[model samples]
Target: MPLRLPPLPALRFFEAAGRHQSFKLAAAELNVTPSAISHGIVGLEEALGVELFVREPRGISLTATGADYLSYVSEAFSLIAIGTQRLPNHRADRPIALSCAPTFASRWLLPRLAGFRARWPTVNVSVDTSHRQVGFPVDGFDFAIRMSRAPVAGTAWTRLFGERFVPVCSPAYLATLRDERGALSLQRATLIHVNAASEDWQAWLDATGADAIETSGGLRVDTIQLAFEAASMGLGVALGRKPLVDSDLASGALVEACAQTVAAGTAYWLVSAEQADSAIRRPELADFKRWLVDEAARFDADVAVADAVADTVPDGHVETNR
Candidate 1:
């Protein structure tokens, strides 16, 4: 029997918009426009003879019909996988499809991956680096590490760690800081900035409350890992995350330019949805999450150690001890 369905283009648009709740954002993801998504949804609803979304002032929401239809679509995709598709090779036997933020993956998870492998030698982990929420039905991803200000609703979520941004550079950069406030210090050096740190320098200014020199000029990088790399290579001071550079600072690859660091007003979480129960489900995800929480606990300990170390020494001590 020949089967017929609405065009996948329309379904894809609706799926993205429904999941994100903003056609504008969905458009960004789809590389389309708000009007295009609205048109596509209109076409889809007309084809089905029912509206899939309730248009709202600020954004769209699932209507009762929309929500019910979504559940069916979600299950249909799952059935497709279970009924015919091959699962991602078993994590215990192959790579677990792990998703994470690029910076977090590079600076944090990669450093600890070997340990995850050592603990479960049979388990292999593959990482995806995008700063967006990926759900299970579309892709067979086993788990995702998401940076969210709030817990990811409708998923199993665990608090990973909150972030704090601090200015970091090579020890050689700070050697020139002959003054207590590091005054006349960074002005001579370029200040590399990253998009994630839009508020970082501003917050540091608040923390230090100084106007001695402008610390806002240097090589601009699009990615945090690149910024850290530049900072390590003597390019300029980079604002870095606590977990990302804790190892670097301890190893002296990078040194703090300013003693004060401020919170980034966001956090990260490890999430798995209900579809996580598929046969492709790997025990290693649970294991990895437990390991991550413990790792975060150690970072918390490091923060405490850093604070105590900072208190014992004065603000402009500049010795840069762990």
Candidate 2:
């Protein structure tokens, strides 16, 4: 269908001038010269075959026709602006889709996600659980949180934090060990083994000189988070990541079954393709990136404080026994 309408620029100039009651003010608002606004209004009035504004020696005032036309034009512009605002949120609802390991998502990211939401109310996020690293851009994911020894190829990576592996057990299980003399031994206690994190348990055992304890002989879990849950339920001791267990320890739901901690070599990373060509239209990715980095920084700082507290423990403290 052929649509007949006045030139858009002319309508804009008339609406602005009518709203302000002065061409000079309309020019300033539109970032145009007053002469331009005046010409546009003149062209518009000629097309409409009516005077929109009556120019006076002092300034200008809208005529009856201009005032009536303005009511409609102003409403149209307001509607356009409101519609534009809702578009980004429609895109935001898809969320900045991320692929991450189930254990890390459950133990670390999920626990602190509320803070991310508070800071970025409009940027939605969804986490995909997989031990396998998904191909970036190819998989169409906006980001991936991974525990990796090295960054995946074709993607830029930012290290979030390294992990320290330590043995953790429920408070009930720890109560059974308070009476043990010298080094606390877990020889008889059931050990929780996560197939994916066997190395962490092996590292902790090696560091604590508990070489005789069989790490392979225990209930095997598929994920580290489940292992922590098992340990928290007084099922057995689980090799836990320090950052993941911080809240549990603080809440007295879990405690250090052993003081020995070993660096797990792998670290958590935020990764994405270097070029944002795939999902650049989703501006929420940038907001999520900045927020994740800020949250990671705060997490590292909190871990540092915990480390300091552990170091400054008094001689009679429970940690001193290890």
Candidate 3:
């Protein structure tokens, strides 16, 4: 017997609209007009002989029956996605395209990607270092890592880690800033700044109660990576963001100018497009996500251990010059 069902397109429209509870957002996700979403959903409701949504002047709300039906529709789509992915022709070598910030790609992900390659030798990962926030699936990106205080809209995300800022500079630069008491002073120190993080220095100063320090003049750079390089070269002190600067600190290329660390009130998140099938078709994507989460956890644990050790040491007034 033939399966009885509503129009597939109409069902899709209903699912999107119900998921977002806004025709406008659903339209954006599907790359259709809001009017089209409204009309399609209306057709779906008519075919089902039930009112799926309560239309309001400001927005839409799913009815009880609509919510119940949506779960089944969503489940069916998931099953279809799983089956499609399991098809014999689906190549294991298909690449996972990722979008992220240039600084993150260079300073963090690239260095650790070798571990991912070892785990999934057949899977290829492509990195696109674009500042622009690309829409998932539509933009042809498998995942994106973004820095934000909160998760980006219309995407599922995992919080990787929070950011903290500290003053960092070359050993020679730090030595030059030291007074007769062997204490570091920022009064005459050059404050290197990043254009994107203009307020970082000021924020750090506020946190450390170093309001007396002059922040008016400094060498400005386009990215945090450049700022780090300048600091390492003894040009000036830069407010280095953690994780990005972790390698530099570990390598002794840069040292903290002060013991104080200020939270940036932001964090890096791993994001993927909000879709029913997200990563279901790509087992590699799942593996990549697991690996990323584990790596983040390990970093956090290492930081925790270091902080514990530092707590046992006597606090000193002397700060690193280099």
Cα lDDT, all candidates: 0.74, 0.77, 0.81
Score every model by TM-score: 0.69, 0.64, 0.69
Q: Per-residue CA lDDT of candidate 2, range 1-322, in tens?
A: 9988999999888877887788887787678999999999899888989998888899899888888998888667655543553565544457778888876787778887898889888767888884443543434477888888988765799999888888889988876755456445667668888886677767777775777777768888887778878999999888878788777888888888877667778989999867544345656677788878888998898888877797687533343213
Per-residue lDDT for 1-322 in model 1, tens only?
8888876788878777777878887888778999999999999999989989998887789898988877777666666755443445532355678888887887788887887788888877789875555757465677788777888556787887788778898888767654655453555556788875566665665665545546555688787788888999988888878878887898999988876677777788877765445533546667777887898788777877777786687675433221
Candidate 1 residue 286 Cα shift, in angstroms, is: 2.6
Whose TM-score is higher: candidate 1's or candidate 2's?
A: 1
- The digit string of per-residue lDDT tens for model 3 on 212-289 reads 777879899998889999999999999989878888999999998887878788888999867636456566788898
Q: What is residue 239's positional error in candidate 3, in angstroms?
A: 0.8
Number of backbone collisions per candidate, in order?
A: 2, 0, 4
Once model 2 is optimally superposed onto the true structure by TM-score, how far is the C-alpha of residue 104 displaced, in angstroms?
2.4
Worst-scoring 10-residue span by lDDT in model 1: 83-92
lDDT of 2: 0.77
Clashing pairs in 1: 191-217, 191-218
Q: How many collisions between residues are there in candidate 3? A: 4
Better of 1 and 3 by lDDT: 3
